[model samples]
Target: MLAKIIQEGLLNHGFHILETRTIQYGTQIRLLEGAIINVYRTPKVLVQGKSISASPEQLRKNLEYVLPTRITVWNLM
Candidate 1:
């Protein structure tokens, strides 16, 4: 799954992961230095004040999600 790929990717990049735990919504990876990453099992996205929630498989197809060391977000139209 994409989540596992990201987990491995972060591990390869020298991220000190404090914990990997599952909450009610999804899995959360706690890193050192008070940073946390959430890979939602079911991602809920809000676009233009509308809530859109879906399963991982569904979101994977409809969304293009990425995680990088530097934050860069683009609103694709």
Candidate 2:
């Protein structure tokens, strides 16, 4: 549900979808920018990457709009 929405949002915004797989917790979406978005079964989302904060404003806003309240962002620079 949420994961699918995020995926579509990213795709519509021109972010390449590298891969999508199911993990122990939930669904994981990998983007071309080396970012990984984990959508947990508990309705939590974890976004990790070095370039997340450094990404374009539109991309950042898109993420902010698409992601839910239970979200965590990690900058792995």
Candidate 3:
């Protein structure tokens, strides 16, 4: 869906999109230093390293899994 949006946006701006694809997963993953590609993050990845910011979804999922019930309950909404 995001790729389609991006491609359509590019086409609207007179740019061409050579390809489009989508990836769905059920596990959390992080981006490395040089790899700048990301589709989505899952709900099972733990984040405790220095470069903790991967994506909002990944961060929220981890927080909900590790945090106390009080904190997790609010963000879940």
- Top-TM-score structure, candidate number: 2
Candidate 2 local lDDT, residue 7: 87
lDDT of each: 0.47, 0.73, 0.33
Per-model TM-score on C-alpha atoms: 0.52, 0.72, 0.27
Better of 1 and 2 by lDDT: 2
lDDT of 2 by residue, 1-77 (tens): 87898888778877888899999878999887667789887778887665553555544555676567556564444
Checking candidate 1 for backbone clashes, the offending pairs are: none
**List of clashing residue pairs for candidate 2:** none
Which lDDT tens digits does candidate 3 get at residues 1-77? Answer: 43344334435544333333343542222223111122333322222322233454554453344333331122211
Q: Report clash pairs, candidate 3.
A: none
Model 1 TM-score (2 dp): 0.52
Candidate 3: misplaced stretches above 4 Å? Answer: 23-38, 41-77
Residue 47, candidate 3: Cα error in Å is 23
